[model samples]
Structures are given as C-alpha cells and as structure tokens.
Target: MRKLVYLVATTIDGFVSDAADSDPTGTVFDPVGAHAAPLMAEYPEMIPTHIRPMLGLTDTPPKHFDTVLEGRGSYEIGLAGGVTNAYRHLRHLVFSTTMTGVDDPAIELVNTDPAARIRELKAEDGLDIWLCGGGTLAGVLRDEIDELHLKVYPVVLGKGVPLFGIPTQDSRPGLDHFTLRSATPYDSGVSLMIYDRTR
Candidate 1:
C-alpha cells in the first residue's frame, strides 16, 4: 500500500494560525514560502546557536517525498492568487468536496473517497504521499496517516488553526515509532523536527 506522509510546520503553542487567521503568528517562521532564512537573520535572539548547523539553515525547497497531497483549503493558501505549480516537481493531488473539478493541469482534484483513493495510491509501485495542509482533511483521514514531518517553530500562538483537527480515540497516532528523522535549530529558537512513522 502507499503511505501518507504529513509534512507541515506549527507553532510551539500548537496553533497554525492566529485568532484572525490572517497569517502565521510569528515573523520567524514561514510554512508556505521561502521565508525561513530571512526570518532567522532578523531575529537571532529567538533561535538557538547550537541548532542552526543541524537544521540546514541554507536549505530551501526541501523535499521529503515525491508526491504531494492537499485539501482544498491547503491548496488555496498557495494558489488563491493565481496559478503557480507549487509542487510542480512532483505529482499533486488535491482533496475537495466543494470543487466540482480542477482546471489546473498541475493538480488532480478528487471529489471522491480520498482515504480509499489514497489506499490505491499506496499500492502503486513506489514513492510515499505527502499530505499537504489543513486540519479538516487530516481529521477526515486520520487513520490513513502513517507519519508526520513537523517543523516545530518556537513561538506560541494561543489560538488559531490547529495542525490536526481530528482527535484519535480508538488508537494512538503511533508516535513511538517515529524516528527523529531529521532536525535543525532555526535562528528564531524554533527547531524543525521531522518524524517518520513506522508501520
């Protein structure tokens, strides 16, 4: 089966946005763009000195997998203004119930059973699926997620959007199997931690 990998960044307080939902709470972290470096340089006090080298401060456009999957809201965040193949380098799949279809050739929108469809993708020959954004889709398919690659920024957003909307009741999300995978400290006191789920 194909695997679903969630790669996202969140605040230390566990919120993705602010009360207004206008943008991320801190200036030190940028989840969607090439925002990490500049933010770090501006606020050296926020980031730990020891962690900088480990985090690959110079790295931008990092790739954890070859496939990208996202919910409509998540997709819109990067595409609302216009067309730009955010994940053009790889296969992109968008999950949306409101969208009748997608005109963007770069993305394939699914109005069908997303979880089941993901299962089919997992069965394919190779590559893991990158679950890109929004809590709703993640909540809906909580069972399908196999790993979470979170870039934990140090700031705290008392409230805003959460990373996962679903509450796992029947079983744990399986954090024990996670390999520290990778990590690096940012200049903003934030550390990017990538966790790989083991099945």
Candidate 2:
C-alpha cells in the first residue's frame, strides 16, 4: 500500500495560482525562485524532467514519489502552453472528461471516477503517489491523501484557485484533521509545512 501526498505551493492566504485559475507551473515567481534551491533539494522527484536541465539537476535518485496524479486544470496549463506532458519523469495521470488523445503516450487520463482511480493507484506498490496539482480533484480524493507538503509563499493572492475549493458551508466527506510534522521557513519568506493525516 502506497501513500498519497499532495505536494503543492500555496499563497499565505490559501490560494494556489493566479486569478483566472491557471496552472501552478506556468510561471516561476521571483520570490519563489529565491527559495527554489531548498525545495529542489527536498523534493527533487517532483521537478519536471524538462526543468532539471535548467536547474542543473541530474535525475539520479527520486526523493519520494514515483507516480503523480493531477486534475484537468493542472494538466491543461501545460497544454495551454504547448506542453501536453509536463512531468516526463513521473507516472502522470490526469483526471478529465473533456480531454482525450493527447500527444503524449506516457500520460494517462481518468475520466470515469477520480476517487476510484486513486484507490486503485494506492494499492499498487511504489515509492508514493504525488498529487501534483488539482484543487477539485484534491477535494474529491481528500480521503485518500495520506500526507500534505505545502510550500506557503509570503505573498497573498486574494482571488485565485483555492488550496481546497468548495464553499465552507458545503459538506465535504473527507474533511479530516492533520498533524503538523514540520515547519521550516526560508529566507525568501517561503515556509514549508509537512502534515500527516490524523486518521
């Protein structure tokens, strides 16, 4: 049984991306770049292969996960930027209904049931599963996630894709408590918080 970790970068106010709800990897914020070395050293496997060349990283050994699960919005950001398969290093699975026949053969699409698909993935033997991006899919598979690695930036985006979407009044089945395992702050004002699911 493998663990599912949602490793994401979010604003201090709990927003993941800029307004209009774009992908997290679309642009590298200047502030984030300051703390990039630490994050890259911590989670090298999460770095896209195409980016490693620029970062001067050789994919020798993965840090944590071997698989990555993403939502349509997260995957489409690459497509919108003319990149169909963003994470060439990991086993990428995208949850989408409207997308099909992407150019990449390594990319897998799950349109039927995201939760069910995640459950099946959890049973497989692997390093771990990285819930790379996707607020909606994250909300849907909230129960299956075993850990959370949040990179909290100092900036605040008042309006954007939320870390966890859905109105507070709406009842979500997987609203579980998490125990903070670690909180490390960087000079660039980016704080890395690791949380393990209480259940």
Candidate 3:
C-alpha cells in the first residue's frame, strides 16, 4: 500500500533530457523567481500560483516515506551545486553504480537494481516514496511506479533525452490511470502538467 510518486519536468514533446541525456533548453525556468520581481509587486498569488497547487504542494504526502530516491545524475547535479547534504524534508537514497560513496551522511547510496529495492521499500513504513528521476532511472522503474506527477512545460526540447527511453519488449510499462491538472505558463512558453499515475 505504499505509493511511489514520479515527479519530473518534461518538455511538451515529452523528452526529459536531450539526446545526450542532458536537460534541454527550458526544463527549469526561473519564472517563479524572475517574474516575481515585477509580478509580485502587483499580485502575491502570482508567485504561489507557480508552486502550491501547480506542484501538488497542497496535500501532505502520506506518512509512509522517510526517504527520497533519485538517479545518480540528479544527485550529482545537486552535489556539484554545493548541496552536500540532503534537503530538510527527507532522507536521501541515491542510486548510482559509479558513485562509490556519498559525501552526505543523510544520503544512503544504493548501487544495485533500483526497481527491486523500490518494490521492497513498499513493505516498510514511512512517508510516500518520491521518484526524482532522470531518463535512465525512469525507464528502468517504469513498472514499479504507482503515480507520476508530470510537470509539463509549454516549450519543446526538439531533440533531447526522451521522457521514457525505449524499453525492451518485455519491459514496457502501461498506464492504468492518468489525470491532467491545471497548467501554468512559464518562461520559454512551457506549461506545467501534473499527471497522477495509477497502474
């Protein structure tokens, strides 16, 4: 009865990374910050609009997950940016075969089959599991994912890492439920789409 939430940002074309497995041009825009300088002067809700409901911040997540899971690349990105520690919200579990050790004591490193461990995690008690992804991780765990919070942007990456990498015939995952939520316009003409996955 544990829930796995895949929360990510994808281009309008559904590519999570460029062809080289890197973020496309506008995946993370500064709308909430840039626009805030001028817009917030007129409307306070304009800033919160980009967050809160748009990012599923309203409901408190189920108290079944005390850890957050992210691919190695995502964790590296944070590390390179000087975040040597996990965020205040949750314990971090980073999956990386290449990473020998994690500098952050708060983060535990897992180098084996992530999908298998994720399934095993469901049996434990904590807050809901968050699948902070990169294309490689998503493709691998597509079957175990229970919910997908897709933040669709209005722009297109043209050619970047696809949201779902091509899987082998035996591993393709199918969606059982999908719901579209409110969309907010950001810089680069992208709108965020929140999708709840139930399979």
Candidate 2 shows a clash count of 0
Minimal lDDT window, size 10, model 3: 41-50
Candidate with top lDDT is 2
What is each predicted model's overall lDDT from 0 to 1?
0.64, 0.80, 0.62
Model 3 agreement with the true structure over 49-95: per-residue lDDT tens digits: 12445544444333434567878876666566566653435666888
Model 3 stretches astray by more than 4 angstroms: 20-28, 31-65, 86-88, 166-192
Task: Please provide, for model 1 over 55-154, each residue's C-alpha lDDT reduced to its tens digit, 9 standing for 90 to 100.
Answer: 5533333334567777877666555546444566567789999987775686788999988888988889666777867666777777788887666876
Q: Write one digit per residue (lDDT tens) for candidate 2, span 1-199.
A: 9899999988888878877766555352443455788888888887777777787776546779999888888887788878878788888888888887566889888889787888898898888999978677777778888999998887777777777754466647545899999999988888899999998
Error of 3 at 30 (Å): 3.5
lDDT of 3: 0.62
Q: Per-residue lDDT for 92 in model 1?
A: 77
